[model samples]
Target chain A: MSTVQITRLSMPKWGLSMTEGTVVQWLVEEGTILEQGDEVIEVESEKINNAVESPAPGVLRRQVAKEGDVVPVGGLLGVIADAEVPDSEIDAFVEEFEATFVPEEEEAAGPEPEKVEIGGKSIQYLKMGESDATPLVLIHGFGGDINIWVFNQETLSTERPVYALDLPGHGGSVKDVGSGDLDSFAGIVAGFLDAMGIEKAHLAGHSMGGAVAAAIAIQHPERVASVTLIASAGLGEEINSDYIEGFIAANRRREMKRVLGTLFANPDLVTRQLVNDVLAYKRLDGVDEALRAVADSLFPDGKQANVLDISRIQAPVLVIWGDKDEVVPASHAQNASSGAKVETIENAGHSVQMEAAGKVNRLISGFLDEAES
Target chain B: MARRITFMQAINEALAQEMERDETVVVFGEDNAGGAGAPGEDDAWGGVMGVTKGLYGKYPGRVLDTPISESAFVGAAAGAAASGLRPVAELMFVDFFGVCMDQIYNQAAKFRYMFGGKAVTPMVIRTMFGAGIRAAAQHSQSLYPIFTHIPGLKVVVPSNPYDAKGLMIASIRDDDPVIFFENKVLYSVEGDVPEESYEIPLGEAEYVREGDDVTIVAIGRMVSMAEQAADALEDEGVECEIVDPRTTSPLDEEAIYESVENTGRLVVVDESNPRCSLASDIAALVAQNCFDHLKAAPRMVTAPHTPPPFSPALEDLYVPDPERVAAAVRETLGTSDRARA
Candidate 1:
């Protein structure tokens, strides 16, 4: 039999603040065939429920972690090898990996987010992977920051550079949102790219960010090569004013949890950590006024006031939305003009990027790839 | 900056400096913005007592005035804290804790331990405590011991303007939930406070007056009385050691033990009722912890176990005074082992 080498399968870090996770169950038994991105195990953390995906395709020759075992990030959970590898070597390798493996100190420190000042305001943005490919800038919705892309950024960045930023009035960015309009928000995004010295790149945005990306392509055409909108705004007049109003008005946990629940098809995705994130933003000194200003000025009566003129957008636009989106109403998908390609994801909600990340990623990747070709 | 300012001004300065230093610090309470929803000038009150006066204009939107609803806003502050906001919620009076105690004791205090140690509720509840303002029983009370009883809550009672300012700033930055008590009577009393932002450790106690004759433990407003009693005893050559436990929950029991060990005599001055009061608690702690060091039985001078009287003369008698505290110290000093029996 031909000898086969296998890499030790280490525990994966799913989100930004996940330090350690409990291995709830292993999906595949020992010596099972495993494909790249296959769900090897289910790990539960303080943040969210995530299925650990296999990084490489191989036969799962050994399981190092048992069910209901608590392990730190980077601890070996399993081993993958070609079927040709002898069983004796696999058994010896499992013992050695467990006995000698030491979890990385950096993993224990958790995912560290970085910040840079742009336009005199501190902008927090997380960069993943070291690919020479042009960086893809990910902008979150009205009340989100860089952490929303925690699920996709690291995985997608393996193929190219990826960056997610906190816009003004959100996350670590300056709490003051001047005028709290899309134009100002788009200007800040463009200014941020300019400050970072990026001339052209793919832009991906969620909800309100979708409209901002659309506006960016229309106004600063040279800076954006392509645009991807996830449950984006500016597509139509139909939006859940209740979600917007509830988000702005929610100051307590129970209330914020209910409002955030409207963003996802699986209301369970609106976890305590998620509500805590929004509360943290709302509690900041100027964040409440900033949010209120944006809500009043942009979506005063539950309708988006700023709509991008699709005709002016020069870049290729790919619009993705959840068929069951309660936030921006699935009806808005009909508003996309002739040129833009639209895909309504079934069994998803307002947070299409989060609920259907793989499909959304494939759609965005294909659109950008065609644009590059 | 070193000159005297009212306790309320000192508190205001501490809050203003903290808000300036950290963008996360915010101040909100009923009438915190003064004229909320009113036709006259905005921020007319700065607070009900004008302690937060001028902050609304200085840090617009940061200092907020909420509706009379305490639970909603106080719980909001706790929720905000768990997320990322370090909010300072004012309950107006500690007596009003009835309206928002769940937010403070249950939510803010337990987030750390109950969340599997993943959450940090960095919040501060600032409220007026103690009596002598003639605000009646409903608006006046020293409930620090009740808050101190909660495991995760840090109860802070600053005895003077200096401790009030420093401890308020410290409470704002502390990772655990802190209940900061401001004696209403001391708010108008002047003292020297630093202009810069600084923090005094939460669990530390300060020895105001050092003497070996007797160890007097006081809290909040009672510290001043103990000091006065110590001063009056100086002429008679009966030197008294005064120890102020700035925080009751993270009680500086070691400090009390050490003072008792040195003085071999103890007298506790408390403004609260004599039973189950902080004074009695401290007296019990010293009696149990330093039984061998005692020259006489521990003495506690406190108000009667009853609601604070409404009349000025009766109220004055109801609150523990310096003369009474001095008399307790003298009684404890005069009694020998045979005399005590």
Candidate 2:
């Protein structure tokens, strides 16, 4: 059989900080036939836990890494191949891969996120992959950073160069949110693309970020290729203002954990590290005022203040939402423009891109490809 | 992004950032700027362990190398704080606390209360504590319990690099006198610390590891040992919840009580001597308040009443290790013999 018949399932590097993950357990047993995006194993990093999906559509031939085993990113976890594939072949493959594999070296360190002064304000963004396809730019929601794309960026980057940016008042960027409005956020992103010298690129965003992307597509149609919204805002007037207020007021871990639980379908997924990270961000010098400013501007009186018309954008629009999303109701997916394709994923929550990363990534990459084509 | 740095570097960064932020923030202690007047090079020694190594050059007049007199310098540090300047005075080894007890405990600790809150002693007295580098009796003693006993005095014991920076910044900004203790063995230990200036509020205890079998309250360097013990206990089906109090004074009584209430078993591991130590103090608190939730008697793992040993073998035996912590946990759970303590 050709080498293409077998595919190795390896540990995934979730974010910039994650170098390795421990195998929590095998979600699916050997000999179980799985679709390409089926979750095969549960792996945990220090920051959070995620399900590792199958790389190929085939029967799980062998479990190379056992439960409770610590594996570095790119280290083989299991093997997938046709049911007729010999068992000896899978064993030999695992052994050979281990012998040849070297842990990711610092010498080949991926490009570190770069910070630029956009309109005299510091903007932090990470540029990943290098390919001859339409670049994809990712914008995170309120209280989120570039890490919101931890699941989708690396996966989707294989098809083209992808950019993930930290909005003002988040992550490594300066805690100054001028105007603290959607228009300002859209302007900063447009300026970021200008600084990076990208003339036009596909845009994707989450929650509040979706509004920014939609605003950009409306404001600067010449600078956009396509727009993809994941559990996005601005389509509907109703939003979970309690979550926004709770996130801003949560200085302690317990409160922050409760606020983050609204984002995920599984409340258990809101790990200590995640809560600590959000708390640290909230505690920054100007973060509180910035968050309050943005909240007052957009989500005043517990309502989405501004609603953009996505149909006006000439570019293709793909709106994806988690059916179980609590922060922004998944029913808002239906509010998408008639020209937009809306997909509501089941059992996922506000962070559909992270909860169902496999399907979300596939949908995003495919949409971007068709738009670029 | 979080940049991983040594405990020593974290302390240095906190000092630098605070000094840069406020002109009133001054750093002075013995050998703070070691080679100032007599040597060929300037900014040579940045304290005994170089935690303040490069500060002399960055802030010329602010980094003062005081005479080798603890009473004089520490007294001066207190005086400066009361006079409107934020002084960060390094006590070098906490064993030297005896020479300046009146200055720290009497004057600085009492300024705010005695003066009816009219005076604010924004001073941080940084010192090295714990027994690890064979520093022997005088140098290795964890004398924070003495400071914790005194009212109006805040005692901080940071376990790792991240806490070291945050607590240092917080202590510097605090209006009252703060005793910041750094473990000698933890100086080289490395962890993630943010480049920006942020403070971890005092009195908040961090749960290093969460489990249900037993509550392990470990202070300072003992926190890491408790973590190691928790890992070992996990293999034996004995899960441990480890709590690092971070600050001895203004202790988070609620955290300790809540933890013990959940597990029904308590083990406090402190590197200080057994008498009036944090281990004994926490055990008593849990015993008193969490009485109804207790499944067994609270256990304490502490150093012997004797001074630390000079020899490596005896010193290793004298200090509380993971084995002792694990044994204490097992004893509290009735899974091991009590004689091991």
**Number of the top candidate by TM-score?**
2
Each prediction's DockQ against the real complex: 0.03, 0.37
- What tens-digit string does per-residue lDDT give for candidate 2 at A224-304? 999999999898899998999998888777778899999999888777778877777776557888899999999999989
Docking class of 1: incorrect
lDDT of 1 at A44: 65
User: What is residue B33's positional error in candidate 2, in angstroms?
Assistant: 6.0
Looking at model 1 chain B, report the run of 10 residues with the lowest lDDT sum: B35-44
DockQ of 2: 0.37
Indicate which candidate wins on lDDT. Answer: 2
Give the residue spans of candidate 2 off by over 4 A: A1-9, A23-33, A58-108, B1-5, B28-84, B106-120, B133-135, B188-192, B207-217, B223-243, B252-268, B283-301, B311-313, B321-341
- What part of the reference interface contacts, as a 0 to 1 fraction, does candidate 2 reproduce? 0.18
User: Which residue pairs clash within candidate 1?
Assistant: A280-B84
lDDT per residue as tens, model 2, B40-89: 33537888888898898889899888998999999999999999999999
Cα RMSD (angstroms) for every candidate in the order listed: 18.6, 4.4
